[model samples]
Structures are given as structure tokens and as C-alpha cells.
Target: MNKLQIKYIRQMLGLSQQELGHLIGVHNSLISKIETGTANLQPKTEQAIITLFSEKGISDNDATVINALLEKRKAV
Candidate 1:
């Protein structure tokens, strides 16, 4: 995922970088780096996030859906 997507998802989940890192077994700074575009999101971490969300019944699709709705509003 891109930096924007990561940040957006974190905010949508009401999680701080440290909290997400702790849950996913990474250092918080790594999450900061990923969110700032200083580092790429490693595949394992992405999978971990996906797994965590699945276990929590959180769908990433919600972000896309919200963005689409917002775009439609902008068009009016």
C-alpha cells in the first residue's frame, strides 16, 4: 500500500503508529517511515496488517467506499 493508504487506514482504525506496530510486531519508527514515504511497506508487514484486519472483521474496502462517496459529493 502507499503511504497515504497506510495513514488513512490507521486513522480510520483510530490507532496510533505505536499501537499498530505493537500489534504487528514492528517498531513504531518503521511505521512512521512507511507512512512518510521514507520506506516501502514490506510484504510481511502488509500481510500481517491484512491478517489483523481480517481477524478483527475490518475491511480495507471501507476506505475505498468512503473515498468514492466523497468524490461523488464533490461532483455535485
Candidate 2:
């Protein structure tokens, strides 16, 4: 996921960065860094996020729709 998508999904799920980090077994600072685009999402981290989405019943199509909305919002 891109930074914007990550941020959007977290917000949609009403999760703070710390909460997501805890769920994904990562440091909160890493989550911050990711959202800020200063760090890359590691393979394991991405997988964890995907797993989390699966558990939450958030499909890739949902993510795609969010991405499109975000891009459209940016255009606005």
C-alpha cells in the first residue's frame, strides 16, 4: 500500500498508528515513518497489513476504491 492508502485505511478502521503498530507487531514510530513516507513498508509489514485487512473483511477492491477516491480528492 502507498502512504495515503495506509493512512486512509487506518483512519477508516478508527485505529491510531500505535494501535495498528501493536496489531502488526511493529513499533509505532515505524508506522509514523511509513505514513510520513520516510520509510518503506517491509514485506512482512505489508503481509501483516494484508492479513489484518483479511481479518477485517476488507478486500482489495475496497482498497482500490479508496485509492480512487483519494486520487479524486487530490484532484479536487
Question: Highest lDDT among the candidates is held by which one?
Answer: 2
RMSD of each: 3.3, 0.9
- Please, what are the lDDT tens digits per residue for candidate 2 over residues 1-76? 7889989899889889999999999999999999999999998998898789768777999988889999999999
Q: Tell me the TM-score of each prediction against the true structure.
A: 0.74, 0.93
Model 1, residue pairs in steric clash: none
**How big is the positional error of residue 27 in model 1, measured in Å on the Cα after superposition?**
0.2
Task: Point out where model 1 deviates above 4 Å.
Answer: 63-76
TM-score, candidate 2, is 0.93
Cα deviation of 71, candidate 2, in Å: 0.9
